[model samples]
Target: MELLRSLAAALAVGVLIGIERGWRQREAADGSRVSGLRTFGLLGLAGGLASHMPESLAAVIGLAVTASLVLGYRSEQARTASLSITNTLVGIITFALGYMAGQGLVSETLAVAAVTTLILTLRQQSHAMLKGMSHKEVESIATVDYR
Candidate 1:
């Protein structure tokens, strides 16, 4: 039915992003990565399902999701001694896209999902670009002073 299709799209979105995350963290030991394929997949499904619930219930579910993501990130920071929020942000975005798809904005959801995955895939290139830049160059770029 229509709900099934929406949920399927949501799952697909999650899998798409999960592919990038899983591949990027393939070398990390189990439980080390902030989230892998299964976690993202569940998040996407949760988004779709939450979209179908009553507005109040949906809001509560969203809050729960956000809280869980924040807590997970804090736990990860403790274990890794790093403070990156990229994975958490990506997870939230994926959930949003799934919700959009559930709300019948399929094309827009897919488009943004593609862009999201592209950004996630570019992490190495982004880091390399910054690492290759001089401090002055970075400051100039940050300040929008092309001169």
Candidate 2:
């Protein structure tokens, strides 16, 4: 029963985050370079599966996911990407941890899910704010000028 509960919570969290990502992907004008709803959902599910497995295996799975995210980010950076896609990946891992902490059968995972969803949902607004800033303003903050 406890295991079932944890799985449900994890699944719910994954789905919630996935929905937000999906919405953002659909609305994005320039389109996102990151994996969206389905990918996020699967990642969360995989995390949950890892968490339920033996400790060593779970650690391996987590490490693999982290490594993949790092490699993906590095690849994107090499291509001069703007938005960081790793946030979704991080959210999935964190959500899995939260589910594990919640022990799979409580509202605690919901709270975690809410926070993750909020971040994913607000990404566009955050990007817009960054985009709206002037190069001079950024340079002033950084105390360095390109020119």
Candidate 3:
């Protein structure tokens, strides 16, 4: 019924995110990336399910999921010396959106998810724009404190 609908919404949120994320990393060799569509989908599902638990339990579960994603990011960063935290942040956001869905906030969840996916989808264009910028152009916009 309602729960099923919520879960479906939650899963949809994950799929949306996963599509963008997977597309962003399409150049990476197979099995190279730590997460893809299925992983994101599962994370969303987990968040929705966690919402059904008692309040304290839900909080604990949320913390655990966040911690795990952070730790995984840290581990990958250390191993590869990569500085990006975008994937981890996306995972956390997806989970939150799923939790929102479970709480009967499907519209809000979808809106946020759409925004997040848009950001992910714009990666190449953003990088291209940055690369096209002159040094002075970048310096002029950068907010650095002289003092």
Between the candidate structures 1 and 2, which one is better when assessed by lDDT? 1
Considering summed lDDT, which 10 consecutive residues are worst modelled in model 2?
97-106
**Best first by lDDT, ranked:** 3, 1, 2
Cα-based lDDT for every prediction: 0.85, 0.67, 0.90
Candidate 1 lDDT trough over 10 residues, lowest sum: 29-38
* TM-score for each of the candidates: 0.88, 0.67, 0.85
lDDT of 3 by residue, 1-147 (tens): 999999999999998999878777788888777787888998888889888889899899999999999999999998889999999999999999899999999999999999999888888899999889999887887967778
lDDT of 2 by residue, 91-112 (tens): 5465465436335544766776
Q: How close is candidate 3 to the true structure, as a TM-score?
A: 0.85
Predictions ranked by TM-score, top down?
A: 1, 3, 2
Q: Report the lDDT tens digits of candidate 1 across residue range 38-74.
A: 8888888888888898989988988888889989888
